[model samples]
Target: MSATIHRIGGREPSLEPMLSLVAPDLNLVNAVILDRMNSDIPLIPELAGHLIAGGGKRMRPMLTLASARLLEYSGTRHHKLAAAVEFIHTATLLHDDVVDSSDLRRGRRTANIIWGNPASVLVGDFLFSRSFELMVEDGSLKVLKILSGASATIAEGEVNQLTAVRRIDLSEERYLDIIDAKTATLFAAACKIAAVVAERGEREESALDAYGRNLGIAFQLVDDAIDYISTAEAMGKDAGDDFREGKMTLPVILAYARGSEGDRAFWKEAVAGRRVADEDFAEAVRLVQASRAVEDTLARARHYGQRAIDALGGFAPGGAKDAMVEAVEFAVARAY
Candidate 1:
């Protein structure tokens, strides 16, 4: 399918459609999240709530709800599972902040920054345990395997990314592998579980998985592109955080590959923790723009976003499908 077909009169795409479609069910998921995150230790709730209650798109859990709706799932079994997905995602964010030594998330103080790394890591573990508890309560071996495996893969992805950090030679393929494991696995699991709950066949489950996995990659690519171009106000996080942290994202990889000899030396220093200043970031942005790295990174995102939309072609055309498609559009359009 042509990419332009998804565009509506050149208007910006928004997540509102999917959010609206899933809002009613999302409330119940939110209730489960609130209830499950409670504990006897006051600090647990306080720290966890600091990040949980903080503004978030809740994209992972919303995928669960929307996928269930797509399958015409009439049962409420998905509510707790969806909450479990959110818990897993939240735990990862907390740990990620600690790992990255990040201070801001969603335009507010990070959990690690406020509560300190020890507290943040412990709370993250608590949330992970809570997610497993919710999974066991559901009593589906298949569901248990999918989510638990995703959790492991996400951990593995984090370690993989950690090792690749500041390595100027990091290849695009390796970066894709890291992101597929770290970010896309949960998205795939979240959508696939809806098929399991609905008692649908493997075909439907796989289709939803493909939709989410592609969308997740697309989403992360947009985020990587935005890190260089967007502001803290727009991104809800520091704009140069990735650059400062020496993350080997696609834009960097492309720019480094396509740059001149001196451009490459600048990237080497930038990635090696040598060049980091407002002016350095300004130069980095200029290099990426000149090389069309950001533009082509977005092109790659649109490519995956289109695959995500095509993944839903087997499902009957309806509001659920439309919302899901527009969600893909929104994912690819964010950097524009």
Candidate 2:
């Protein structure tokens, strides 16, 4: 697809303030991250450092930390919980890169490409084990169960996507199911763990869980929408990755549904028949624009983002609450 990328067509909300609000707790989370990344085996830390040092926002752990403080949590257990959340996220990133056969992550060479898939997967396993260890040491049965269930769900989601390869007829319902498992489950867990540690009752825990889940859904929705609307520079990776991979993201699903009989055949050939040429991508841009697929995708993202914002209604107005709201706005508007 020899096309210029465009940015998301709306204003973006900065997450800087949110990060700043959680900065102190995040520092403690960072300490735990560095401490736990250590291994006497030597290569484990080296391989893991390559990805960790590449540096994305590390938002999952931050969510845990911020959620904890939002409830005025006094104990230090959230620090370990936050670290565990990060380990789980990092492990998933490692596994995702391997599954996608990706070479770059956060604009650096993926651990798999540099150290080989064997090392990447093993180190990912180590991180997952480390996360479980953190949860166990915290000795919260509720925390352990919630995080472990989320971990298992993440694995199941990956497997589901593996089975979805080349199946472009994937329905939006199923697609959401996959993302809820793979992405939102952890976000939900990250937020819910705060309530758990705070000893906040079920109402607050469920609300926080809903907030994270909806925020995560909005976040991934923007990413899917951006594949059609964003620039290569903005995306930090090539657009049309979903199409190239034959994955049925929202835009593709909508386009496929609304397209004509001939259009459907074209899509089937491009993906299911495994005969994609460059022009197919160019035509994809056309179909996506014609169908207003990107707009619809973002509308869905906004809907979920609004739901995420609404989830915080019970909480009083404060910096942490405000930051969480801004974080949801950021999720939906990130492509912008």
Candidate 3:
């Protein structure tokens, strides 16, 4: 599923404590990204800054730092690795907006919408190239292997989603398979790379990898939930963007499966058939809610959150590790 929803806004200061372990480093990483965005090429720098300042939660890189700290990694490579993750993520956002023909992202005009698709796509490529440069600076073939593998998986996931979009016969199992490839694989790689850097045991590395994978799945589940449940203003983007784009997310899959005959027919004609009426959007939301899919998806997320915490139990938990646990918990319980 797409995860461009939610921001650092809406919540109060209390949530700050959940990410305190690596917030300072995260801020530094942001500065590094901004500084690197500077280019002699005139409008390139400005457009890059506009995309960078669009206000992201920086969740991917934060996970990298948190995972490193949890295992007592004390090297500068962590920062570079974190920034690499962010670069890949930002590249994906640029490409996703173009593929979806999106106009709004984080409640602002998309780079494609304002600067045009050519610029957005080219800048995104620039970010990808810069990320590869950072990876080379890390000087670890293992790190390169993990990240390159993730990049490939992310691309495959995008292709899988394109093949499945608007197909009502899409099963819940297939939807999950797509997300596991597209979303969770990179997250798993991020944490696993930290484990490799920390020289953790094979068993611990696998456990941490599992933790990241499960956490990523939980994160995406909540993302899908918020898209169906949140308002456009609060979510920092248009609500039902997925529905309008003919993407078959979890909520719609469950609702369409359980909908009454008329509701089902309406979805087939409007949602699947690409003739979405005004009532179709509202009714899809209602049917999904009525199916209790949101509750079911939330339960799945909580299950994954619990599993992630369990994975961390193999290590000697400390303040930083405890903070990582709290971050995962907060990710699930976050009211975005």
Q: What is the C-alpha RMSD of each candidate to the true structure, in Å?
A: 1.2, 4.4, 4.2
Q: Which candidate is the best by TM-score?
A: 1
Quantify all predictions' global Cα lDDT against the true fold: 0.93, 0.86, 0.80
Number of the candidate with higher TM-score, 2 or 3: 2
* Candidate 3 residue lDDT tens string, 1-336: 222212235442233554688887888888778766667786767777776788777778888888888888887678888888988988888888899998788888888888888998998888888888889988989889999889889999999999998888888898898888888988888888888888777886798789889888888888888777888887777888888778888877887887889878876765565666656678777878899877777777777777777788788858766666666767787643
**lDDT score, residue 152, model 2?**
97
Tens digit per residue, CA lDDT, model 1, 195-257: 999999999999999999999999999999999899999998988999999999999999999
lDDT string, candidate 2, 201-311, tens digits: 999999999999998988898988887776666776666777777888888899989999988887888677464666777788788879988888888888888888889
Who is ahead in lDDT, 2 or 3? 2
Q: How does model 1 fare in lDDT?
A: 0.93
Query: What does the lDDT read for residue 57 in candidate 3?
Result: 75
User: What's the best-to-worst order under TM-score?
Assistant: 1, 2, 3
What number of clashing residue pairs does each candidate have, in the order they appear? 0, 0, 1
